[model samples]
Target: MPSAAARPWRARWRIEASPVQVLAALLVLAFLLAFLVVPVGRVFVVAFTGAEGGFTLVHFGDFFRTSLFIESFWNSLYVAAMSVVVASLIAVPLAVILARHRFPGAALITTLGVLPLVMPPFVGAVAMQLVFGRNGTVNLLLMDWFGFRIPLMEGLNGVIFVQALHYFPFILMNLTASLSNIDVAMEEAGQNLGAKGFTLLRTIVLPLALPGYLAGASLVFVKVFDDLATPLLLNVTNMLAPQAYLRVTSVGLGDPMGYVISVILVVVSVIAMAGAALILRGRDFATQQRGGGGLARRPLSPLGKALAWSFVIPVLLLVLAPHVGILLLSLATVWSFSPLPDGFTLAHYATVLRETPQFLTNTLLYCGLAGAIDVVIGVVIAWLVLRTKLPGRKLLDLMAMSALAVPGLVLGIGILRTYFDVKMPDGASLATSWIMLTIVYAVRRLPYALRAATAALQQVHRSLEEAAENLGAGKTTTLTRIVVPLMAGGLAAAFVTSFATAAVELSATLVLATRDVDAPLSYGIYVFMQSAAGRGPGAALGVIAVLTVAVCTYAAHRIAERERSRRMREGRATA
Candidate 1:
């Protein structure tokens, strides 16, 4: 720490870092304006403009007038709502079980719960066909034994099932976090007042966890609503996203109807998130007790444990089925109208690895740079919002998050429309370039990284930074030494999440990738899944994708677990 002699010389040291500060702030502002605001603004422009180049609502009117459009709109809403209900039903009980009790396989259960999030919904949809399709495993067994087969993978029902199974982890994560933070006194007091079983949970637990649950639910709804892969792959085009995709891809880029759908997606996303926000605003979630024991874990009786396992085991199997099917499909040389593969071979893996090294290399290049960009921007945005007094920082926060409101398809279209003709500094067309693709990835996944960074920053004591300043360190030095180090783990989590998600991103890539070689694993998988003989190679690529994502996810899980354990130890010592 510097002494008083250095203090006077170092006063207003913040101004000394203005160049770095100003440059970063300006860069972020430009990036947001250029990529996010401009493209979205273009969508609204095209969506609302008439053929004569004046403002009109004819596009929306046309959309509402069409039976297909109207049906797709309603179908989207129906599927999203059903997904939420089913996901909640599956998630709430498991969250309660995890939070309120200490049981066998608790740790394994948590790891499994988070696993689905790593796989893209559409990618999972492919393998899901093998496990839940009409002639798939479950239905085959049902047909053999019970003389019945459920339509698990039929139409929008299939979309909802996959969505529910894949997305329930959102609710599970939120509810578990909320439950862990609930004061033990609340539960004990409720019990003292004669509340028990579902009564206690409904009144005390659910009410408290409501905000987190709804937040998660809203996210699931938006995600399912805007998702392009699942509905398309399942042949369920009577949904808004699939409609938008089909409209834009099939008809022409000049059609205003697709932009209209994009506008609707953006609007619905904003409204959903805003509704969740409104419900949570001014509601204090702070635990009444300070630094004491949190929610108490109840020890389950033998029968209770058995019952819990009974509920959990089947769900776990259903969740794991897609991955198992993918692995089998990748290795199978011939899988047809049979219960099992007729033959297996390593040839598929070898073919993909040899024929298309670009798929893997492009993914690494694109996702790595995108992840790094996300982390840097995320840390900068978090600092600007929480640490600095920069003007318009709130708008920066808003814009970064609003990227989430924009679906991948819309953003991809926006990018194509806005940048297709534009030339780079070197006079190269921006369309379908790796740089453009990387920008999309970074912006699309920016919210996740920003949220993680902001949350981490909020946890750090402001006093720590102030001390460095008091000791005559400048803002940059202090941040580098204190804030960045403290936030490294969270920033890494943010990076991994962004990287893994972008690795499997398809909607945007589908539009932006000009050639097959420019495409990543997701587009390759989609292309391969188109052919019967290509399914093995596609599945092989998928396994590679899954393994890549799984490794990152497990690393993140370990980091989170270590952080939690450290915090618990600190809290215990303090108490």
Candidate 2:
């Protein structure tokens, strides 16, 4: 009934807010439902509901009745709490030194301190056991010097050591940002009021940095609590995550107790992250004025330098010990309860290369596929949130971030629960195929990629897209040419990050892997490490994971550096 002119306008409106956009929005909704919500919902349903479809707390009752389950729940809580405390102690000083002082090798130390993150916690657990174990170097020194060895690598203490070292950088990264960006006038005003030294630091600086500290500490707590591999590797099995994996696998997927554990993990993770966000909601921690030079850097005196290094050197040595130990272990012929290996050989590496080429191949294929899917979805989500006027984009963004809070073991169980009976159009069960592993990898690693894409997109000037459109290009063409090219380096970095991380994902992969032949490098490494003779091969495999992640991490840094240099040159050229 519309006129021709009105029809044209309506057509344009339809194109602008078209079926394509609607389809895309629907796809996002469906994807989140299929991958995240349903699986998690299934877990809750199975956890609290009986097989007869009646609501009951019987599962939880059964779980509490078992002393081991109660022990595991508390053990998880204790480990997480201790990890936060120890990680804070280590991180606070390092962040203070790096952000507020100028010193030799400070830059290098900061970089190396973050390297532990590139290696998976479980992968490094192997090397950490060798270095920090009671019969290890520190103990060896103590035993010879004082005839006493610390229990650094025993029981829950062992989990705390690895997790603290591994996760302190999370706090360090956040605290560094906070300290560097803190308003200089606040400190100057406090100093003018006669406050000085540690008192000033305690009352003024740390209070201002508390938000960042809490943010990082909460993440550390959640991550440590959700982790299964580190505890399983360290032989500390009485934790919620490990128990979830064991009960579901050993007792079969129908176990209600496993689902109860999954729901608890999911709840705790969401609560921890939500609590952080809620605590920051009403506060205005923003600095009114940030100086050009950021925080003031004071140079250490000669004696002060010695004291600083005295604290820092031991930490650096302890942090980098895993890297050294893993490499040495890979080549060691025999190493057991010794300060150093008795002998060395290259046979382990040779063995890995000569046999089990399937794992290497599977890793390459799975990671590559997952990385591509991640980048594609990330770019779409980033564009929708940043560029489009589409509905539910904010919801899409929230869902993406929430994925990080889901423990991999829980996700895996959810996938199994939700899709075990799902059949492909080709009539194959999706739950029993390698495709399931790929899907799990993609979902699990999507957050990192999405964050990268969003950040990269934010850095891009809108005028470039406008200019392309001004030249008669469509939105798609403008995006494909102007935007994608500008974000290529960032997108590549995102892809590498996803790929490298997916390469080492064990928890979800362990559950989703239909068979051993489809298993990736992490499972292979875990299998090898279960036996005494297999330690050498396992170390070698762990080395491969380390190198895989390290190379990708190095490349991402290089790409970022080049992009920064290019931007600087462009700014200078324009100026």
Candidate 3:
């Protein structure tokens, strides 16, 4: 009925998925649907449902009518916005200096800049209070010398200060990488056209790096917006995230206010992500061409060097304050309203190791499983989206990444509401099990692993796979022998990224941890920080958490470097 050309085109339009591809797609879809879509959808349904079980907007209306809810909503918005601004101010100058200039100790500065990320913002809240609180060291000194104290850790200001310091690394890392990729020719062209110094940077360099800046900014905004632990630690419960947590825990799940707050969080997250995308749409900033080099690094003059070091020294000290404070607190016998500790000892570490070693054991078990699940799922999703022609493959990728927009607190609530009634064979509800927490960690961190896997897969060029197939290898065989081996470094990195981040996760764990024995290090730290006697143990636990994350991050970096070096050697041999 059709010509030869038409027949070929029609065949191309039909589904080209292999049986293995189809099966993998279905399994991934089922997992996401069960754990992610269904749970989140359940929250939406409860938020919109009335007392009579009919669809209505009464809960939302009530939310708007309440003055407290209105205040909480605005408070969250203000904090998120101010955090972005402060984080930007800190990150931008640092990123530009590191990316656009060559200076002494540059590598060391870069490493120190990212040290903040190893410690969670919530953990840092405690140390911040110790360093900047009303009765803390800085204030004590200020009263003694300057006769005035700065309210750096007062109320909302404390949350902003801790969040900005801990999260600015996101913007710094992204912007620095983006800036490193820009073509030198663009800057030269601007300079040739009479643009110089600040003018060239503002008009050309900054605009080119905008996509990266926006990416990091949006992440900061979403992270700060849905953060539950930091605000709670600061005793600031007037924000949306804290309110949602309180309403759910204090008022029970059946109370619609928690669901309402969750829905609002999800909406705001989606909007922030969408707004970044909209701003970036239809704008192309690609400047690099084959054989072209990155932006030219300028050497700073003597005065310029002095100015750079002056800025760098203070920022480094500020960023590292939490680590210093926590370490000191852990060893301190008494450290209130003093510029120095009264005494130092190792009793807190000994206490944690002797009494609550299960916290560390539980973290390893939970986050290890979560990291493994993420890498496996991430690889499957990456293969499906990139290699297969299965219908809804892109949709599967989107769904996996959509976890970014779902707040950890919201996900915890959704999982509780959706699965609490579904009993296991052991008679315990699935939502109450430790396995569910593992799944939540996996789901929340899947986006990071997926991106890592996708990048790894992309690096293993199609030609290598094609050559394997041409030599009589089947799809599965080729993947196992050629593709996966090549992607081993990236997969390891992905696992570590997921594992490290999950190790410190507090929002979802706060909701799901039902017992002390079952809880992880994060929950232990939180419990210990609730009283004066426990602050020592809490700070000790915080140090352990930081060490765990730092180790994993270092390992990932080394693995990636080794893989890159191996590839370079292979390329040279081939040439």
**lDDT of model 2 at position 169:** 91
Cα lDDT, all candidates = 0.88, 0.87, 0.93
Per-residue lDDT of model 3, residues 82-149, tens digit only = 99999999999999999989989999989999999999888999998999899888899999999999
Candidate 2 lDDT by residue in tens digits, 349-373: 8998888777788998999898998
Candidate with better TM-score, 1 vs 3: 3
Candidate 1's C-alpha lDDT? 0.88
Stretches of candidate 3 exceeding 4 Å from the true structure:
1-14, 288-291, 467-472
TM-score of 1: 0.91
lDDT at residue 519 of model 1 (Cα atoms): 80
Model 3: weakest 10-residue lDDT segment is 287-296
Model 1, 187-286: lDDT tens digits are: 8899999999889988887898887799899989999988888887787888898888777778978988989999998898889889999998998776
Model 1 residue 275 distance off true place after TM-score fit, in angstroms = 1.9
| Model 1 segments more than 4 A misplaced | 1-19, 280-287, 423-429, 456-486, 559-575
Clashes of 2: 0
RMSD of 1: 5.2
